[model samples]
Target: MTRASLVVVNYNTASDLRACLASAREKLGDAEVVVVDNGSTDGSVEMVREEFPWAPVFFFGKKGKV
Candidate 1:
């Protein structure tokens, strides 16, 4: 199987991120998921970390660019 990477940039949008992850999980199997939090104050990083522990989470500083 081919390996894939899913990169999701979150910015105070928790619901959308959850939905996106759910859909990704259903469609892509055995793929790596990466969630990049863009200094979101709505607990987006924590939510993703708790829900998708398998995925690697990255938190950028204020106005930080990737």
Candidate 2:
């Protein structure tokens, strides 16, 4: 079976991202969760690193580079 990835693009929304990831973790079974951070200064990247270590994070450390 081919697995699907849930790509979530984020900025400075740490709280929101946390909630989203939490829900995904509880519900998404075998579906890879990928986070593409767009240079967030509000600790979004750090939060993901600490909380969702299983999810891969691709951080583009320059805002607006979507």
The clash numbers for all candidates, in the given order, read 0, 0
Runs of candidate 2 with Cα error greater than 4 angstroms are none
- The local distance difference test score of each candidate is 0.86, 0.91
Q: How accurate locally is residue 54 in candidate 1, as Cα lDDT from 0 to 100?
A: 82
Error of 2 at 42 (Å): 0.4
RMSD of each: 1.5, 1.4
Quote the RMSD, in angstroms, for model 2: 1.4
lDDT of 1 by residue, 1-66 (tens): 649988988889999998999888889987888998888888888988899898788998684686
Query: In model 1, where do residues sit more than 4 Å from their true spots?
Result: none
The lDDT of model 1 is 0.86
The TM-score between candidate 1 and the true structure equals 0.87
